[model samples]
Target: MRTPARRTAAALAALLLCLAAAPATHAASPHRHRAATLDDLARQHGRYFGSAVDNPELADTAYSDLLGSEFGQTTPGNGMKWDATEPRRGVFDFTAGDEIVNYAHAKGLKVRGHTLLWHSQLPNWLTSGTWTADELRAILKSHITQVVKHNRGKVFAWDVANEIMNEDGTYRQSIFYKTLGPGYVADALRWARAADPNVKLYLNDYNVEGLGAKSDAYYALIKQLKAEGVPVDGFGMQAHLALQHGFPNDVRGNIRRFADLGVDVAVTELDIRMILPADETELAQQADWYGKMTSACLAVRRCVGITLWGYSDGHSWIPSTFPGEGAALPWDENLGHKPAYDAIRNALTAARS
Candidate 1:
């Protein structure tokens, strides 16, 4: 019997042969004539279409133009993270994040702060030094307050505490969790709310797009927070999908459960990846998944938006992290639209109708 990876490779090779004999045509032909931009179609259905961008990508003129034209919202991929904002303890910097916010304003795009608190990518000062519980709690409060205050009017939403739970519904034993316990989640949300009363505060995570142990944990936590009148406003599903793993089952149902908690839902950081050297079959499957994800979000009234991790394959983070697996975004390396782009547009158009 072939190993899973070997099986995947064999399947991919077979698909390539079939695609080589196929005629050229629009990948998502039925919806190609809908000239409306994603943002335009999304607006008709009381939603927004968005993409995440990093600071360095701004230097590319072509990338910038497409970002400005194609999406109505943008999230700074790393600019607002703890390490980026406060490289040194007690010293805060918003220069990088500010650039993205300013660009968003110029383009008439809404901004979603990538994150305010997370376990990874923390500064050396905080992670290296030992701190008493009191000291760590004070430091955490100050960071959230200062960062959120600085971006108050600029960012409309924030991932207040990200990836706080493991796949088995247990909390990750991060420094914050080790120090402050699970109460830190609620405290972080409270601090953010105090800093920016108008901004929507969200708990974001990957692998929680479907009904599973991880998502169930969030459901319980969200319910508890709501009962306590905490200012939690949303849950962000970072739908980073892989073709071999299959799409999340009942994604609409999962999103609806969160919406039932009286908090909005969003497809944050969505990217569908397949093994490299993608062929027509893999691309078609990817396009179908994109449409399904968009349709899932649209099925729920409180699902506010969908944000691609990045809009194009050229600058995606997948190849570096996953190795040998990429071609994840809606655009190819040359800034040209892929089949997934039309699939998303088609879904949005159908939602409007």
Candidate 2:
């Protein structure tokens, strides 16, 4: 294919693809004339717009109904995590995860499995036990295989491993990391792939939405994983923005760099949080930031989607997590559209033109 004769053929094919990719940016469906939802607008540009949901929020019919209608996909905030899935060794509980997956399906929303492995919120059994490397590896493998196989066709993607790196570009010393060494990340991905060959496996993390030590570490690791024929499908940038930290530097460029590594990039777990009692000015700034983040994802071909941590501030975890900060979503506590919501909509809608 690299021969001189094939070069011209390849160029022609590239041109044809470019032509096909443009001109009709939006998807054509029967409901095209109706007011575009965020998901509908994103679908036009070949991407999904989603939000994360917790099981307790499902009990709030008003919230759940709106969530089901507005978004194209959902990630269970805590439902699919290791703590919730496997409480005891070889004992699995899927009640929480099943509820969300079933709800998403019933509402015509796709599910991105929150995570198969993470450093935090792990069950006591896993953390409290002292096991040999062989024992721990077996434990991890069984958990991933069972979880992925159980939800095989239900989820489109998995955060196969989450928050595996520290801020200084070093691997986080999680139980898996401590027991199985750095190879654990790749192993988890392989196990997930073996169980659910069709689901996209990803490395999900926060603080990687921009060019920094943290994002750089992922860039290198993903490049190495691909070079070694690992089954990584995407990189999840938990775009948990804070107004105090300023917008991530050259986010479109950051997304592009990961795309170059032959892995799709996603704005997974996006939220723009602000100080308590947000005002008109802070709200407007947050809106602009949201618009920029949306536009950045739309610009990258391999950037598959964006998923908010939660849709409304009413259910946000910011207040509890960060003492003085709250109001981190596009929707207010009363399910009212904040300025950020319209900004996101405008960006997604503009992508079609």
Candidate 3:
């Protein structure tokens, strides 16, 4: 019904309005915000951060984000060991360990060298070959020297020994014990300290959260070592727990006892594994468990910090280690924060305040 000139003017005005809004629509798309970095996460809620870091592609990004962030400490697994560090006798390799230490230092994060002596990750060559006591001693010395000397000032703490206790209250028979006897633990600590006197030494282990046979053994061993004036400085409680198993009966008391030993305690490698996809009840239980663990650490003066095993459920070792149980981290695989994370942050923040 309108004239041709009127129609043209109306159409032109509509076109102009559409063009004006195009830029704003583009800016509001989902991918506008930058991905959160480790520093961002730490500043929000983290003190000690860690990842097993199996993938090569993401290791650098993960490390930079974690160590470079406000949270500034790292503990390497399998990277700084005899098997990986010196796969061939007298032929040392620092490729993986070097990367971890370098990344940590770059971000101003304190590096904790995960363990000089663990029975599990030893190279087959070291285990299978027959060597005299002196030869074995020399090999041990060289492995420590190469790894420790490489990151002298950057590395702060070292787990001198790890998981020596069996669930049945006996020392798990390891090649070190089989070859050099129990004195090997002390000897190893002495050698590590001599190599780098500034590095704080610790004994790291799992299943020592409560007064069970495992803890009893660890306590007895430490008591003896203390009497002998061993240079051991701290204890690492690898609190790899599960909600179904229920929280340990006396975890806080156990932590307190360890602190009373005149040594610091750290909840290294902490994760609360849920056996099933967490329902409301399961999630609630995890929150309670996290609260208790954080409370325990808060109560103890020497409990320096707690580090979750991985940042998200997707990267958690639980699915592989315990099939059908994956959601064990504070954040799920897609980076959505979970109730467990919230509980821990709340607990830590309240305690800090």
Cα lDDT tens digits for candidate 3, 1-353: 76799899999999999988786656557666856443344344434544444325235464336435535566665578777877887788878877767766676667778778888888888999998878888888777776777767877788889888789888779877777778887888788888888888888888888888888877777777888988788888989998777788698889889888888888888888887867988887887787778778777777777777766676667898899886887777666768887787667666656
Please write out the lDDT profile of model 2 over residues 1-353, one tens digit for every residue: 35697888999999999998886655766467767789989999999999999999999999999999899999999998888999888899999999999999999999999889988989999899999999999999999999999999999999999999999999998888888999998999899989988999999999888899999999999999999999999999999999999998689999999999889999999999999789999999999999999999999999999999999999999999999999999999999999999999999878888
In angstroms, the error of model 1 at 345 is 1.0
| Decreasing TM-score order of the candidates | 2, 1, 3
Those runs of model 3 whose alpha carbons end farther than 4 Å from true positions after fitting are 1-70
Q: Which of the two candidates, 1 or 3, achieves a greater lDDT against the reference? A: 1
TM-score of each: 0.90, 0.90, 0.83
RMSD of each: 17.1, 14.5, 7.5
What pairs collide in candidate 3?
38-65, 39-69
All models: lDDT? 0.94, 0.94, 0.75
Q: Looking at candidate 1, what is the lDDT of residue 185?
A: 94
Residue 49 miss distance in model 3 (angstroms)? 5.5
Model 2, which residues run further than 4 Å from truth? 1-33
Ranking by lDDT: 1, 2, 3
